[model samples]
Target: MADLKGKSRATTTPADGCALCSLPLLVPQEPSSDIEDDEDEETPSHLIDDVELPCGDHFHWDCLMNASKISPVDKLRFCLFCRQQAVTIADDGSEKLLVHVRNEGGLTSNFDLGEEIRSEIAFDSNPHLRRTEAFLSLMSQDDLETAEEMLRGEDGAEPVDPNSTYEEGGLTALHVAAYNNNVRAIELLLRYGAQKDKRSNDGASPLDCASQVEAWNAVQVLNS
Candidate 1:
C-alpha cells in the first residue's frame, strides 16, 4: 500500500476566515518562510484520507464517507452530475470544511484502511459468527473467568454449527476463537473438536481468515 510520508505537496494556507463553513478564505499575500512542509499535518481529529473534489477543493476521505451516508452518489460529484461544485470552502484554514458547492457532492472511501496500516494480515473462516457475538456479550456481562467457564462448559463442547460463518461469513467455533484473539479460547475450541482446515463459503481456510483478520497472535497460537 502507498504510504504518505515524506510525500510533499506544498501545503498552502488560505487567508483567515470562517473555516468551519463556506466563508470567504483570506490568504496572506506571501507565505512566511518558516512554515513547515506539513503544516496541514495537524487535525482536530484523525483524518481518514484526502480526496480530490470536482470543485477543486479537497475533503478528508472520511468526511466524504460520512457524507455518503446521508447523500446519494450522484450528488457526490458535481462535475459528473453537470451541477456546480457540490460543496466548497477554504482548504487553507486550520481545518478543511466540507460545504455546499451547493449542487452535488459524492464521497469516496478507500476501504483498504485497516489492511494498509497493519504490519500483518490474515484470514479466518468465521463460522458461527453469532457465537463470537454471544461470547462478546457474555464477556461484557461477566468476568473473564465466567466467560471462560461458559466456553469450557459441556465438557469440552464447542459449537458445531459451521453456519456460524465468517469471512465469506461462514465460521466455526475455532474460527470464532481466533477472531476473538483469545489464545486459550482457541485451544479450548480446538480441544472441543473445531476443525482446523475447515473452509468457508468463500473457500477461505482457517489460516486464510486468520491472515486477513491479522490475528497474528491467534494465528501463532492456533498453528502451534
Candidate 2:
C-alpha cells in the first residue's frame, strides 16, 4: 500500500508506458543546443527522466508538470492518478508542498466554459465554505485527487461531509457530481458515505439531479 501522507513507499520501476500520457518512456538524452553560450535556453521536456507519482504511477516529467499546471496549487496537493495525498518530508520532520505554476493545455483548457457558470459558488464570509466549493469544483472537473483528500481529511483538515449542502446551489457533493455526469466522482462520493437519497434544498436527490441534467452515467451509478 502507498503512504498517503508523503512520498509513496511502494517500489516503482521505469515502466514501458507513462501512466499520465500513455507514451513510451524513452532513454533520457542530453539536450542538444546550437547556441552553446546562450543562458536563456530552457532544457527540453524530452531530456527529463521518468517521474513517479506518490500513487506509484510513472509519468514523463513534462507530462506530470503539464498535468500540474491545470490544478490550483492551493487546492490540489495530491496525486492526480490515485488521489493520494503527496508531501515532501523536510529534514526537520515537517512536511512541505511544492507547487508548480499553472500553464496552458491542462484541465482548465479542456473543461467546458459553461460549466463554470453552473459550478457551486462560495460565500466570501466563511472560509469553511471554500472547502465545499473546492469539493464541488473537483467533482465538476473530475479531479479525484483533491476530492479524495477532502473526503478523507487525510491531511488533518476537516473532512468534507458528503451530505453537506452548499449555500449557493443548496446541493450536496453527490448532486454536483450527478449534475456533471461524473460517474467516477459519484462512485467516490457514495463510497465515502454520501447518501444517494439525500435531498437538496429544492428536494432534489442525486438521482433527481442527474435526471434533470440528463446525466445518464451518474444516474446509473446512483441507481446501482
Candidate 3:
C-alpha cells in the first residue's frame, strides 16, 4: 500500500501525470523520521499542496524538503535550480537570493533605454512581498534589468509596495539599488525621483546602508 503523505487533497489525480512530476515513484516514500530518529522532522512545514516552483517531480512535502536541503556555508554559493547566488540562511527557511546574470549574446550592452523606462513603468503594485534581501543582493550584482523585473508586480507598473520596507531600516528598493553601487541604477532612481534622504524605519539613510555594505562606489554616486 502506498503510504500517502498525510492527507493529499487530490482524490482523483491522474496516475500517469502525477501532478508536478509525471513520473510515479515505484512506491510512495515514507517520512525520513520513519527510518531515523529525526526530532526536527516532526512537524512538516511544507505539504504537497504547498509545493512551489511546480516541478514534474512529485514527492512528499517532507521528502521534497529533504531532497532540496542545501546546507549553508560561510561563503558565496549558487542554487542548482535557479542558478542564482545564495546570500545567507535567513531565519525563514528560504535562502536569500541574487539574480542570475549571464553575458550571453551581450544583452547588457544591447538593452534599450526606452525599453528600460517602459519596463519600469510596467511594474504592478502588490508585487512579491518577500525576499527583500535576495532582491537587494541581485541589484548589488549589477543585474539591474533582472532585479527590476523581479521587483515588478503582476501589472508591472510600480512595485507592489512603493514604501515597502526591504530591510530593518527604511531601505526600500531605491535604497538597495543605491547601496548596491550601480551608478546607472542610482542615477535612474534619482532621475525618476526616488528619495535619497529617506530614512529606513531605523532612521538610516540609503547612504548608511551603502556604507555598511562597503559599497564605496555607491557612496560616490550618491554624493555626486
Candidate 4:
C-alpha cells in the first residue's frame, strides 16, 4: 500500500517541460556514440535543477542560462514561451521579479503626465503617441537599432517628440531611458531635444526617477 501511495503521488505531479527548448524536463543524458566525438555537443547543466516562471511554467536552468548568453544582460528576464515574469532560485534562496501594472489606457498605472499635459495632447489622432509607445517598448526590450529608427522616423513615419510625455506617467522617452540606465538611449533622446529637467506629474524628473531606481549611470549622465 505504501509503495502504491508513493507511486500515486509521483504520478500526480505535473510533468515539467523546458520552456526554451520545448523538450520534456530532463537531466543531461549520457552522450550517445553518434555525438560522442562532436566537440561542440555540450552537456546541459539543468539536469539536476530547474526554475519556475511567474506563469507557473518550469524550465531547465541550463536552458535559461544559454538563452541569457545571446540576449541583453540588462533587460528584464521573461519566460521564453509566455513572455511573462520568470524567476530563478537565488543563491540565498530569495525570489526576485519585476511587476508592471497597467491601467485602462494600457499604460503604466502608477504615474501620470498631469491633467494639463494630458489635456493639451490630442490622444485620438496622435501618431506621435503611438510612435513614442513603440519606441518605449523597443527601449524596454533593449532593441536599440529599431528604437533609433523609430525615434528618427526612418520608416517614413512621422517624427516622434523625444520630450513627449506619456499621458499615464508624464514620463518622457528620457525618463524611460534613465530609469533603465540605458546610456545610449539617453544620449539619443538628448540629441533629439529631450529636456533634461522635465518633471513627471509626480514632480519627479528623469534624474529623480533614476535616483529612486538606483540607476547610478543615468543619474550621473542626467546630472551632467
Candidate 5:
C-alpha cells in the first residue's frame, strides 16, 4: 500500500472541480525569484495532489484516500463517481492506489469490475454460493445499461453465460428479470439468446417465475 502519511503541499490546482468534494482545486503560486537554487531543487510544493480517477476526473489525493478507507473490499478502491477500480494489487498482494502516469492505462482498460465479480462468484468454493446469489440480486436491481452490459460483456471481457443458473434454485438471469417485471432486461436477454422455455431446478420456466411475482407484462411478452 502506498504511504498515506506524507503531507506535501499542492502547488498546482485543477480547473475542473474535485471529483469527491466538488470544491475547486487549489492553485499553486508562481515560483519566486528570490528563492535559492538549492531551495528550488528541493521537493516541489503544491496546494493539492490532484489524482486522476478511472473515469478521467480528478480528486485531491487525500480525498481519494479517504474514500478508499470507507469503500468495500470487493470494490477494491473503486472511484466514488464511476465505480471503476482505482487501485491495483501488487505482486505481493498488497493493494495500492494507481497514482502514477504509467498506471493510467489500467484505469482506462476494458476490464469490467462487474465481470470480475461474476467470475469470482462462479469460481467460489463455498457451498452457500453467496456470491452467485448476489450476482442474481444485481440482475434484478441493476439499471438497464448495467444489465445489458453484464449479459453482452461490453467491456470486452468474456461474456457471462446468459443461461447460467443460480445454485440456490437454478434461476437464470431471464427468470430473475421476469420475476422483477423488468421488460427491458427481458428484451436484452432474449436478444442475447436466452432460452424462453428453459426450466429452473424447480421445473419453473421464465413465465412461471413471472407469474409468481404477478409480472403480467412479462407473462404477456413471454406468451408472445
Candidate 6:
C-alpha cells in the first residue's frame, strides 16, 4: 500500500471512503517524494482507480491489492468488513479485483472471483437475513447448542427453520455450513431437520457447495 502519510487535499470525501488509507477517494495529491519511480510505476489516474467491493465499501485499488497479498492461501480474498468474496466493477464495467496467483512453477495468472461465499453481502436492512446470518455465524463457530435453541424457537423467539432459505440466493443453513467446512455444524443442522440434499437457488446441493470451496471435511460428511 502507498504510504498515506500526508493529509487529503480534497475538501469532500466519498461517503463510502477508502477503507485502507481513510483518505478521500481521489488519488493522492502527489506521489510521495520518498517513493522512487520504477518501470512498472502506475500513473496517478490508474493509482486512484477506486473500487466498491461486494460489501458496498469503497477502497483504493493499491490498498485493497496490498491487503489481499497478506493472505497466503490460494482461495479468493474476502472483504475486511464482511467475509464475503470481494468483487467489484471496473471502469469499463468488467469484473475488477481479479486474483493473481503464482504457482509452484513460478507462473502467474489472473482469475475473476465468480465464487459466492455469502448471498447477503450486507444485511443491515433485512431483519430476516440478519437473523439467518447470525445463525450461520453460530454454526461456523461450532456453537451447536445455541444454534439448536434458535431452531427450536427458545426464549419466545420465532423458531428459525433449519431448512429455511435466506437472502436472494435461497441458501439453506446446510449449504452455508457445508460451504464453510463445518462438519459438526452440518451434523447439528441435519439432526434439527435440515435437508441433506437441499439445493440453493443456483441448484447447488450441500455437497456441491462444499466441493466448490474444496471443503473436504464437509464433503466427506455430506457424501456419507
Residue-level lDDT for 72 in candidate 2: 51
Model 5 ranges off by over 4 Å: 1-137
TM-scores for all candidates? Answer: 0.32, 0.43, 0.36, 0.43, 0.41, 0.41
lDDT of each: 0.46, 0.62, 0.46, 0.61, 0.63, 0.64
Q: Show pairs that collide, candidate 4.
A: 27-47, 111-169, 112-168, 113-170
lDDT of 2 by residue, 71-126 (tens): 55433356667777755666996554433211211111121211221222223335
Model 6 Cα lDDT, one tens digit per residue, 1-224: 21222222322234655777787665545566797877796645412335455565666655655554454323335676566776556788755455432211221223343322222223423566667777877776778898888888884678887887766698887898888898888888888888887888989999999999999999998888
Candidate 6 to native Cα RMSD, angstroms: 15.1
Clashes of 3: 17
Poorest stretch of ten by lDDT in candidate 3: 100-109
Candidates 1 and 6 compared: the better one by lDDT is 6
- The list of candidate 3 runs beyond 4 A from truth reads 1-59, 62-141, 147-163, 167-170, 211-216
Q: For candidate 3, write residues 32-96 as lDDT tens digits.
A: 65566577766433222222222222232233333333322322144334434434444785444
Prediction 4 global C-alpha lDDT: 0.61
Deviating ranges (above 4 Å) for candidate 6:
1-133, 140-142
RMSD (Å) of each candidate, 1 decimal? 14.1, 18.1, 19.4, 16.3, 16.1, 15.1
| Superior candidate under lDDT, 2 versus 3 | 2
**Scored by Cα lDDT, where does model 1 land?**
0.46
Q: How far does residue 113 in candidate 3 sit from its true spot (Å)?
A: 42
For residues 1-224, what per-residue lDDT tens digits would candidate 4 score against the true structure? 00011111111222756667777654555655675565677654433233444566655545654554455433335566777655444579654442222211221221211221232233334756667777777767878788778768898987666777776878887888889898988987887788999999889999998999999999998888
